[model samples]
Target: MRVLAFLDGTLADPDQAHLRVDDLSVLRGDGVFETILVTDGRPRELGPHLDRLARSAAMLDLPEPDRAAWERVVQLVIDNWSGGSEIALKLVYTRGVEGDPNATPTAFALGMEIDEKVKRARAEGIAAVTLERGIGTDLMERAPWLLLGAKSLSYAVNMAAVREAARRGASDVIFTATDGSVLEGPTSAVILVRGRTLYTPPPTIGILPGTTQGDVFRAAERAGWQTVVESFPASELTSADAVFLASSVRKVTRVHTLDGQPLADSTELHAELAKVYDSQYD
Candidate 1:
């Protein structure tokens, strides 16, 4: 099932939902967006997603999102999603039509059923290869114009990296900085497990702040595990007790292999973490 709603909290037929060809989101990729995982009709970690959306908009010099209006649209989508037990809910805000002096921002909410492939990856884990991000970790501070930490609509580089991973016979990718620091996945946050501690790179390193990673850390802390936010070298990934890629729709996915090198089997540990992770949705 699919659901669509506009910023005004009015439902729209999915087939009729449209955007102008001149919309800046199409013309210049000038927009911000968030993908949230909805379970049992409830959008998970919604507040954080909205918070990040506002941050992205501000970073792009766009108007601040009206939170209450967006929330209403989300609820409207959820009310219309009657068949799916899980939904990949996306919120998008774009600078409106180009060259139109009176154009206002365009915003909408869409919810669709989660793909079976995503479910399989979450359950069976995935193999990934590391790719260099071609920039140093300090570039974000050096060039703020890059919008490094914002979840903007310009994702060509990210998509290209994913394609590169596929060409290399891998299902996903982990991006590393020129300084050899582990960064993040093309569409997810990278998490490394060592003994009883969980580690993830800090958002200061030019990666989007991950909502699912935050939830995973909270789940770990509640389960008596230590969690650290710091930068670690890419070399550490292969040596870690376990590695995971966390995202909203995929949730927590273990890395079975990195660059075709088999990672240590941590099924028991993964189960423990997965249980804790799912409990957050409860």
Candidate 2:
């Protein structure tokens, strides 16, 4: 099942929700968005997602989103949701019609069921390959206009990387910077386990800061594990005790194989980590 709501506190049929043909979002992918995981009709970490949405909009020189208004839309979707246990609630804000100075922005919220494939990944783990991101680690610092950390709608390159991974017989990808530093997955954050510590690349290296990663780290810390934010080369992944990808919808999934090489079985560790992650809802 799916539900749709507009930013103006109005509900709409998903099939009827439409945008102008010349909208910047359609013309040039000019906008920002966030996907929040809704469990039992409640959105998780909603505030952080909205904050990131505004941050991304600002990065694109778009007006800051009206939080209260957006929140109302989210509530509308939740109220109308008749789905199962989980839903991927997406909030989208776009630059409106092209060449229309009087045009206002387009915004909406969509709630859809989580795909079975995503659930399978969470349960059975995934195989991933490392792909070159074609940008130096310092590019974001040198050029702020690149919008490296923003979750904008411009995802053609990211999708292409995923397709490349599929072509390589992998289900996912771990993007590596031109300088050989590990960045993140196209739709998730990378976490490496070594000893009793968890390591993830810092946001300064041009990756979307993972909200789920932050939650997992906090959970891990409370469970007597150490978490660090630092950048390491792709080679470090091969030597790590275990590797996982963290995202809002998927939460966390073990990387069973990387570049066709099998990784250590961390089933016991994965369960413990998953336990802490689930404890947040309690």
Candidate 3:
């Protein structure tokens, strides 16, 4: 529960008192955000996360973020964190109050302790269910207003999807396109392994480009594995030697079951992939 926040230029406690009702993030969910993983007081894959945040902000037509300010704030939160080997650093900036387009954006950097659930999932694999996202891969290109590729504050739909997965006795949700193509997880990226080939859905398919996945791919390439970015069907998860949901915070958690069907043996492959992941940060 340890937490700190940098609100605008002010460093303060991240309690309810620091939040404003009129903030666009609270009122209309008009904002962009990034969740970074800090291990041993070091924030991993920070450059890519910042790049993605800026890209998402551009997509939303929001003001560009102040990188130096954000870096200072990130340091502030990290310095204030008292416990935990891992931390979740969340950066948020909204378009500001409605009708005041020129209003200064409401920005904050939050540092909080990582949840124990993440460690449990990494230790023991998780079960997932495939849910239709009701949109195709081409929709992002045609309907840019949908903001499908941007990581925005409007996550109620994703939260509901995860809740629905919980109701169905699953730990997470893998969203498939309307055409049954595996898109991604509600908050993570999907990766499948067959032999030495690692597959992840193409970012062109309207999925957020995963910084963790990118790091894994780079590590995999260095380990003499082939990495492919392509649109894959949900059935691919069933046929793969291993399946994982990857994100900055979650890292790589093997998926033990998909739609109640057990996946292939993931223990060996999970260890190998994890070795590659660990080697990168070390």
lDDT of every predicted structure (CA atoms) = 0.92, 0.91, 0.88
Model 3: residues >4 Å from true position, as ranges? 7-9
RMSD of each: 1.0, 0.9, 1.2
For model 1, how does the per-residue alpha-carbon lDDT over 1-282 read when each residue is reduced to its tens digit? 788898987788888738889999999999999999999878889999999999999999989999999988998888888876998999999998999999888999989888988999898999899999998888887898999999999988999998998898788999999999999998999999999999999999999999999989998999899999999999999899999999999999999988989999977778889899999778
- Pick by TM-score: 2 or 3, better one: 2
Sequence-dependent TM-score of model 3: 0.97
In model 1, state the lDDT of residue 132.
Answer: 95
- The model with the greater lDDT, 2 or 3, is 2
Model 1: residues with Cα > 4 Å off, grouped in runs: none
Q: How many residue pairs clash in each candidate?
A: 0, 0, 0
Whole-structure CA lDDT of model 3: 0.88
State how far residue 239 of model 2 sits from its true place (Å): 1.4
Q: How much does candidate 2 score in TM-score?
A: 0.98
